[model samples]
Target: MKRQPKGTRIRLLLAAFAAATPVAYGFFWSEVRGRGTPDGSSIEVRVPEGATSLEVAGVLAAEGFIFRPRVFDAYVRLKGQGRQLKAGRYEIPRGASYSYLLKVLQTGSVVTTPLTIPEGLRVPQVAERLAAYVGDSTATVLAWLTDPKRIGELGVPGPTIEGYLFPETYRFAEGVGIPVIVRAMVGRYKAFWGTEERARAAALGLDEREIVTLASIVEKEVRWGEERPVVAGVYWNRLERDMLLQADPTVQYALGEPRARLLYRGIDSVADHPYNTYTQPGLPPGPIASPGAASLHAALHPADHDYIFFVARNDGSHEFSRTLREHNNARNRIRLARESAER
Candidate 1:
């Protein structure tokens, strides 16, 4: 066989090397693509809205969530997740594989903070709790809640979204805006106010706003689940008889702050405020606190009783009475029991 020219042989070797380059690259990529960086710490990565895959990869790499931005971008594209990456604040774990991190971003598994708004919390209280969770101040959340336009947009028929901020446990994405938080709570209230609940309110000759107001009062009055409807019935009876509600919660609310215990002087003094149900002939202008679903239901469907009064038994329950004499007797009995216990 004739020997090839040295230059031709050299060209052949170069061609062979070029042809094997992609295979070598494939082996190297496989080895590193699935391997996680040796950092066992967590880092937060924020992908802004409308960010491209390349931009997201850069953010992750810069944040130390990944070792190679270009490799991440290529992997995302290969997995058809280039357009699926969601915009949010994500807590990327250290040593997470590219695939795992990509999945987290694509699925929008953003970090969330849990916030629980308990029953009978006023808007201000709720705002304070929300501020602690979302890094917004109570004033900021209150401003968002009290904005008439925002309240109107939420379909809450009031000057403020007081009763419309449904009390429930919520998980919010980190760095969520105030409007988004308010809207979420109000939206939950709207959703809970189903057609049946609305119909019940109409049947009771009360609008949605009135029902919510009464429910809030009932929520503040009773802590026992079974006592809600009975307490609601007492209030309904008082309203029907044109009698004073004399709800202590209303007095506390009118004081513009929470009190560990309501004094008789405070109750008497708050009678001048419009929210003073003891002096005001009708329901207050709006809900004093956020009522849960149970309280709302109780307001719409009060127990069928002639109870016009109720006094707490100091046991997370109340004693109902149909007549003033009976109510006074119950109060005296409660006082005596307390005195006896102290002795």
Candidate 2:
């Protein structure tokens, strides 16, 4: 072989260097900021609360997000984003890169399920509503709800946290615990009572618990906000007069089974029960169900009216009366109207 000139050797070395530089630069850029082509298939993964970057990287590795977790961990920490990892259920694509995964975790764009708890549902019903998200059996969720220690921990004054869980549409993280869900609901309840609400409660000569109890009955009796205050006033008048509330909803609560209508025999059946307000002279031992904000406000601010009785007409509205004779006439009219409609 002939010996080459030193200048020619130097030129060849520089050319090789120039070629390798772009390749290395491209690889570095891809590792730092590029995303992989997403495949259609994805797996669900959960990053636990307070999870470190290395632990999250390990989870991704085991779930097949990446082949090398240490490299990914190093990538996360070196970028000063270790503490930015959020905890929640996530949908990870099979072909995603470390950069993409970090982006998902950093942005905290986790999967959330919207849960709407309607007003007037019992605690057991609320527990059933939470069954799909809590990964527990309905019985287990109920047990969690009725747990004495948990109720005391939550500062609930009621026997079972019945009325404290505010009914609303809540976006809960997928795979969240039952305690977390209940806490969120109770938190909403706490936020609902500002100074104005508390003052109204005091002026009405009622505590939050008593107001919730009455509000629950009002919630069950009426379908519209316009009727809430009037219904509440009927009960308030009965309470003031030392009269039996005779609220059919309270008897229904005692019966525990949903009936299309509460007949006289049904009321007589639970006459001994405290929740049977047709027999009991005052509010029941506790709330029968969760009350909405309007119902709560109505309980605090009942309508000032002399009406002492109300009967549900065939329509959604009710016919209220101030005297027994008037109430009887209204009842007969409602009965005749119903019979006519049936005919």
Candidate with maximal lDDT: 2
Give the alpha-carbon lDDT of every model. Answer: 0.83, 0.85
What lDDT score goes with residue 281 in model 1? Answer: 84
Per-residue lDDT tens digits for candidate 1, residues 107-176, read 8999897888898888788889987887778898788777678765877878577888888898988678
lDDT of 2 by residue, 177-205 (tens): 88788889998988888999999999888
Top TM-score model: 1
Candidate 2, which ten residues in sequence have the lowest lDDT sum? 28-37
**Shift of residue 334 alpha carbon in model 2, Å:** 1.1
Model 2 residue 153 lDDT? 88
Instruction: Please count the clashing residue pairs in each candidate, in the order shown.
Output: 0, 0
lDDT of 1 at 234: 86
